[model samples]
Target: MEIVTTIRREVLTLPAAHLGPDNPLPPLRPLDETHRVEDRDKEDLPRDMARQIDYAPLHSLLPVRVRDGYDRRREPRPIDTLVIENDRLRVTVLPGLGGRIGSLVHRPTGRELLYRNPVFQPANFALNGAWFSGGIEWNIGATGHTALSCSPVHAARVPAPDGGRMLRLWEWERLRDLPFQVDLWLPEGSDFLYVGVRIRNPHEKPVPTYWWSNIAVPEDCRVLAPAEEAWQFGYERRLRRVPVPVHDGTDRTYPRNSTYAADYFYEVPERRRRWIAALDADGRGLVQTSTDELGGRKLFVWGRGPGGRRWQEWLTEPGTGGYCEIQAGLARTQLEHVRLEAGGEVSWMEAYGPFDARPDGEWTGVLRAAEDRLEAVLPRADVDAARTAWQPYADTEPGERLATGSGWGALEVLRAGWKLPGTPFDESTLGEEQQPWLHLLRAGSLPEPPDSRPPGGTLVARHWRDQLETAPATPLTEYHLGVAQWHAGDRAQAVRSWERGLRHAPVRWPVLRCLAVADQEARHPERAAERYAQAFDDLGRVRREAGDDDGSWTAVTAALGREAVEALLAVGRTGDARSVWQRLDPATRERGRFRLIEAGLLLAEGRREEARAVFDAGFEVADLREGDEVIGRLWGALTDEPLPEHHDFRMRPTP
Candidate 1:
């Protein structure tokens, strides 16, 4: 089949006569095709949003020529080199400058290109650097000044004693070359870059070194990765950190959005390699992975700033510049060393492509299979424990402060909202946060709830109250009673129950969360903020003492804090919101998605077009597919839409 693709600068279009090894430039081999279509609206999006949507096509781009050259002049004045050719592409070699390519020149198959390469300045960091060689202007001195110099490092391959062998290929050349050539074939309009490093251990005493690529991804893009869990440890102390409970007692009002700063550094115990995907402005997404040579580098799915929430968790932008990096020769800054042999070599491998929803399953499937295979080969004790820790619970005692319920186990009776058996979330009250379920009860508004009088309502209430009244009461039981009353629509009564519960158990995060959520929904965000702040502080203390590493819970607490703060903002509590955000770690504050969503909410409340812009911006930063579980969650919060289908909302096993 004929492949229609964009040739940015056809790497090789030389006649068959130029195919020999003696040729100075290597023939471009077949790289993958670009699948994007110019128009997407005409495409039929899958009815199932969970289904990956394929909106465009990818045209395979290939390399047609290959060549290599070395500077022949001797070392008295360390040799520097330049290439001048009328061919499809040109190459220049600068020795000892650093691990980076000294110079490169690419000329379109039929055009004369005379573009100069951008200079590299350390102060002005750059994610990538490139040059156009054929028809562009030339000035070596100027190029040197502008071009950033990578640290001088030795590569595996060094020039031969004789000049015939023009280039010294690094051991990792085989791995890097293919992807490098492939990236050049990316469709127009999408922005991407590939950087390769050659780590050469010159000393007999091997010392561990870390390699990092500061990929300059688009400012507004979402990142996707499949990891067991994420960390919330902040690199800096002042940076906001999530406050998860190390032992017990967490607030209920905290919102639980996925993305945050605080430096998420994760290591997959079962699998060494990981992959990350990102969607750009044009609805295009890319997936990148680490190669075996790197022996499975830990995946770092990170982006920071108040705008960070939008970029890392679920944001999406097809044409933006977010990137997935493959660092082969290093480990995280403070981890164990990967000892290399005397003649050792370290290489990293990764792959990326446009974000097509349909292909995502296949792409993710491959990673899972690979991870499974790795796990099978390398049995890890930590992996099992981590999995166990993340497992969902099946049942809790009557008075237990339930973090989550199975299906609608807790909401079997709908005093004011409709419930499908076993599903506690309301069919009619779909778009509100979990806090609203309890708030509705406290407000004495159960008349409209479906199944409000489920058979065991009175018994359950009595059971909860009994637990709360027990001497040395379980704060958990009181917390649940407060929830039940709130749902019963007796706002004052619910508060009384919570206040009583707090008196019995003040440090319970759930109690604080429930009360704060109630207050916020009741239009008193200031009071809610205070409670949330206190709950978070207490929770943070627990995490620090226990040395908790997982950030999911901390993220959950932060979400609650943000929710109350956002609510306060809505009620003209800008000062309160500002104060809450100010206390947040710089990373949390910089989460773009959360900020944009907050801004969107503010705009929506104000009835402005900026709300739409904020929504679009939020979408760009979200890692959403056509259909995702989160879509249901968002719909429930944004609109009073019922779930399209019912799944047991039961708080069964998490897996």
Candidate 2:
């Protein structure tokens, strides 16, 4: 079974919840950027640091819709999994979940090298919402997590460098508009698994690209990387350069040594061989090394604090051990994106395997011994040579299709006539979501949904926006134009387009909602609230007249209703907010998110007892963001009662 790859499907019957259909509303504005770092905290900085970490140019999650329609009701669901293994190592890949490496086992010792989660619990971690922890997650696109974290990516069987086969996963990352591939293979008798990654920019201009292969390692291990100084980013969104091994009187190399969660990105010099290791007391754990192009190495630890511990439990099952992340990326830090020039591509090789080093002692000695042992086992020269040997096979066409991903990539490729040699987004993969856009591309007009359904997703890519600009100007076109313009940071034009569309729009709620978002961003909270109210009322009327039997309109209307109530509450319109909440469908109000909203409303009205009761009745918010303080604040608002154990997800030191 040396290096041979055959694709077969198996069901991982974990107690996992479902990622239901995405929210229908478009994410018009950019999310608050988490890459907040002050200049005073830096030591040695890159010359182009300002441009790399500045606000994102393409910020909206358009065409690629938000995946926020999941809940916490766990069932014995069967997850789609694909396996690729050789004699020494057996690897399981979750193609349907961002091509995540679900498990990597060392057959000789029967050890799981990476942290494998016992359950598949979806949380509000991914950029688009639903994300599960554990395994190796491929993060591509902007800062924060990838929009494709819980989504599928195309997978296939491809030839390896040694005339054997390897598993290849490829997808068109919509956020940055770049196509990338990840190829995984294990050699005949090799202990390490080789991963070849490539990102291509087919456009005529440069695109800022971010790629991080995040490996989850057991928290019992001490993380070591070859750097004396590290840039640390905390939940405060502040970045500071601190000494490695020890910082703030804590030996920072150990995962649980700190009291709060943070990221330590090693500042590896240009000449140093790139590698990071998480080794236990006996110095045996996972070690990751890569060729030159993949220059970045980072260690992310969920500290031993209550919030950190709660987060650890949140992502997995009870009585399970926690894990930290040792990641490799294309930049010095996860906060920055490397430049991929037009018509250019960046490719590199990475190897992951079990490492045995000298026993733990002084940090410096342990790191040196670990580095020496890694070199002895899988030399730096061998990594580079393997990359050189793998370049030819990187362009080898995929042999057999094992799984399919989103059709957005196929739409882009078909529109641009791009010749991506190895990663083919075949036309057959195009589904209903892409059909309207396909019609728009071919017929020069995007059509309205059948049977007066709500508007579908909008495309905000430059090419698509240009197409929208040229297409005939109807209410539908104008509404879509507004979405495209809004996504590109053209607020004034987007508003003008939406207002124009409203003049004759038979379906005015979508346009009105866009205007509401624009008003909210422009600081006209009152106007935003009014527009939201109007939008919600219009949508409610549509649902009533249409007599929705399938509850589809109810969900969409309920989503809009939540936004409307929040907008009303922002301006202290408690009564108005209550009215909006009261109008929501009864079943929708029972959701975890809505229940929290219910508590917020009661708290706002000084009904502390009712709010406390809402908390007393245990509820798990499916979309509770990492570092979210709402639950804590609400618990405090219902002051005099103890904060519930389920609600204490604080990751920062209390003020």
Candidate 3:
């Protein structure tokens, strides 16, 4: 018998590129000027002191390159792909496109464990704008698809510690200035692929980060996991935790026949081990497992209704089938819950493999069989203990409630063959899945709204005003109206609109944020500080109410607090800034960006030596070659000697 492990590179040509002038990519906004507000204070200080003060540009912290629409083409291009294979499995990775797993197949049956898109389709679905729907996307840095998702990453083939071959993909996360690496290893004679991940914050200041492994599979697949409860955003945009598998009289484990779409974030139970699987009717599927570090799982399903079908077709090539996502996150939910201290790093390992079931066995049986096989190959300590702990839950009777929390109890109900509540036109009534196209068409008979008037500055604003006047009173519409008013230079009206929206919907974070921005722009520092504080408080309540005790609210609260501190500083209220800074949680204060503010506060307090020390420590971890001019200014202040503006202070440049 022989064992083989090889990796090779190839260029994949996608079929007839969807090229047309109508398919334009979204534009990237310029960096915000307010981010450099601290620099404006330089003029107020004495010449010697001003020259000594360091003013770090926002770019130093977030060195993101925004590619314009012109840089993107919908035409054919030779995409670089990495193919790694062994005796049992083959995995293809697209190093240039987010280092996504383009394909994962079981060799013996030629069964694809992941959904592969025939074309490289980019759509404006991500928070940073461009997103593609297929395979496995490694999300890092701040949430969504991450800024690196549409860009190429560093790739190399290296020897693993165990003397096995490994393919490593890495990149510097622009927003947080953090470095992340993913290693894929296929051990000899093993049927599973081992993925090792590491994220490091080498900078002197702490940074908030997020990580999620989004795996796409065929639509309508049954998902099996041990989560007790799931959190979802309701119609009002509030996060709420509900029973898993079945929530609010609906089955969420699989795609529903309704018109509504569902997106769930599951809170995995506290355990030493965890696993989630998506199986087809034949009980053949993919299983993802990891030890305690990775705990959150998410599911997103697009219904087969008219709007859902339209979005599906618009997002991908016409002939390609629809798919859903099974995501695994490092924290309870998202990066908002994770904070990495300066020079800190976190690492974890996960395994993916295929499993089969006997003709007479259920999906659970297949999962157990796979678990048994994994126990034999992987490290045994934690896995064995977890299996022993989970035996009672697995063996519980159908519909029997367990003493565990809502999340675990829900999983037990799912294990008992619970069916989704039936609808009026369900398969039972129609003898097949019934299409609601006619009903939908009638309901959506209203004509589309006309385009806004030509952009003469105020024209767009007037359009939004008209929308606010006639449209239903919703937080989203009011927020848009406030935005348009602000853009039209009607700051007072924008503030009023935002405040009204806030009063009506206190949970709307964006409205509060917009109000704060309006106040700041209008030079009302006190009002801005108040609004920012309110927003922070609202975020905390939302997270706590949704049971997100794991710091999933980190990003929002951090942003609000930072803005409050800046607003206070802008008004020369150093004492107030210090007070707000002190009130911030340790995790938020530990971030590298916050450390800069702390150093500034110390400088304001005339603690020159302490401030200098802080700056010196920051330089040790910061990358000088990345054009960190601020550090140079700080060093000059401490030494009383002017340093070159663009000198490389590091001993060696980053590779």
Candidate 4:
């Protein structure tokens, strides 16, 4: 059979909600995530394992803005896709969406090897914000979903090791200021798709880096990997080493066996083959194998719980089949980050193909048969050789640009004057967002923001922080400086900087809002409420003075107003919360999130039926968090009415 591979561009239309602009405010607020796995499980682990589990998480997303602007309303939107295929298989990549491989098709069998979503519903899941389920997402540079998940990445055709065209997706991750590239192609007559990933650190110092390739597979399949033990981390905030395949008399390898969402990180021995497969009862499904560099394999199951099922529906249409994630990462678990040294780089190759093994009888036999079949068909040596052959092409300059990504990388290149090979973040990609920073680079000072709104943007990279420290000590400068300090984990100094800015800020609300969040994080509820009230008042005055240029200003007012009401409610300031709510734009008041807030206020005012009435209207909090049970708790407070399916997103066992 002649093997002719081809790559081309196409359009895929889906019902996708626009990923509205990011929130203007920097994320200075405290994170309420459960403590890392080691907090409760440290006593029983090896020293190194425990230490790895204790990796620090970011307190805030300072430089990168929070993406809370998107709403739940969606319509059919045309999405750009790159299709690469051989005679045997086809892969569809959504380059505009973090280069996510949206589909993997076994052409001969006419079966989709991945859990392809029928629609694109943006949710509050990514590290920076706005994430969707399904497809293979390239999780890079952080513990959570990549910020680039909903954003575009530079995509272009590159020379493939097999003398064909490979689709290369490259992007600059803002959080850690790192550049990474992913090269994907299909070899001649090969059953598997080859993916080569490389992350490089151009800085003069070390940087904490994380990488995970997340593949969404059908939930009904039984997951298998080469391991006898695994580390389980659940929303319950506890980590324990459980037996592979089965634990507590439950065969967890099947997604339906568990009652809540959880992650199982397989403890594959260093010398074992690196692979994982999700196969049906007949033992045929997608198998992912990678070179030794990508050692960790994980299974994330949205189990048989009400919340899990509800989330499945929320991410897709009502009747779409559910999916589970089988992941490969650079560390032992997603909880850890590998420190890539200065001038260092990490690269690896992974293959995704169909694995067929029908080893009945015993679990051990099944594992043995699967391993033997995988090694025989596609040995580890071939993957290593693929990586070796792909290296030269990985450095080849991209040709015929297929898509464009954020201008952050180009701005960095211009500012630092660093040269990168293979992946080009061209200067032509710079946009309006980079203008002020470019001015800061050219002129030693940043221009003051026109209005009181958080300066058009804020950059918290170390160099930018250094520049802020040396620039004029203006209110705007101090406000930005505080954000950088907070991102660096110096809460006290950050508060001092914000307060210093507040002393002389002409408008006062910008820095005051930052101070309000600082107080909230410090757990001074009363102070937080008071500060929020003051900040809201100042902002309201500005909003009134500005009048109506467009509807955007009103929207900003509503956004801040919502935050103010929440703060006021936390401290028993019912009247103040009501006042804030009343001041919100009439249209904003109708949003599902606002309706929920209204329900909260009604409950606080002892109007239980009114609160229940709000829920009876049936609303969806577009930004509701994964583990937040606020809606259920609110329902209980109102009446004993059964919790609505749309409102149940509880990820853990009820306390």
Tell me the spans in candidate 4 whose CA falls farther than 4 Å from its real position: 1-3, 450-453, 640-642
Tens digits of per-residue lDDT for model 2, 1-655: 3444444677788888878878889887676555566765443466555457653534556756777788777889888898777777888899999999999999899999999998888888877788898889889997777889888899998988887788899998988888999999788788999999999999999888888999998899888888889989988877878998889898888998989999999989889889998888877889999998888999999999888999998888889999999999888888787788899999999999988886467867777787888889999999999999999898889988989998988999999999999999899999998998999999999888876788898888888999999998989999999998988878899999999999999888999999999998999999999999899888888888888888878658877998999899989999989989989989788998899999999988988889878888878888888778888887786786666677888878887
TM-score of each: 0.27, 0.97, 0.52, 0.96
Off by over 4 Å in 1: 1-198, 237-261, 269-273, 281-283, 295-329, 332-337, 352-355, 358-655
- Model 3 scores a C-alpha lDDT of 0.57
Question: Which scores higher on TM-score, 1 or 3?
Answer: 3
* Residue 185 lDDT, candidate 4, scale 0-100: 78
Question: Which prediction has the highest TM-score against the true structure?
Answer: 2
- How good is model 1 by TM-score? 0.27
Which runs of model 2 end up more than 4 angstroms from their true locations? 1-7, 39-51, 55-58, 640-642
What tens digits encode model 1's per-residue C-alpha lDDT throughout 2-113?
Answer: 2222212112221111111111111111222111112332243223211211211111110111111111111222223323222333333332232233333333433111
Clashes of each: 120, 0, 7, 0
Against the true structure, candidate 4 has what lDDT? 0.86
Which tens-of-lDDT digit does each residue in 330-419 have in candidate 3? Answer: 755442337688777776677788865431244346445655754665554643343343322221222211111112112212223332
lDDT of 2: 0.86
Better of 3 and 4 by TM-score: 4
Give Cα-based local distance difference scores for all models.
0.32, 0.86, 0.57, 0.86
The better candidate by TM-score, 2 or 4, is 2
Angstrom error of the Cα, residue 448, model 1: value is 93
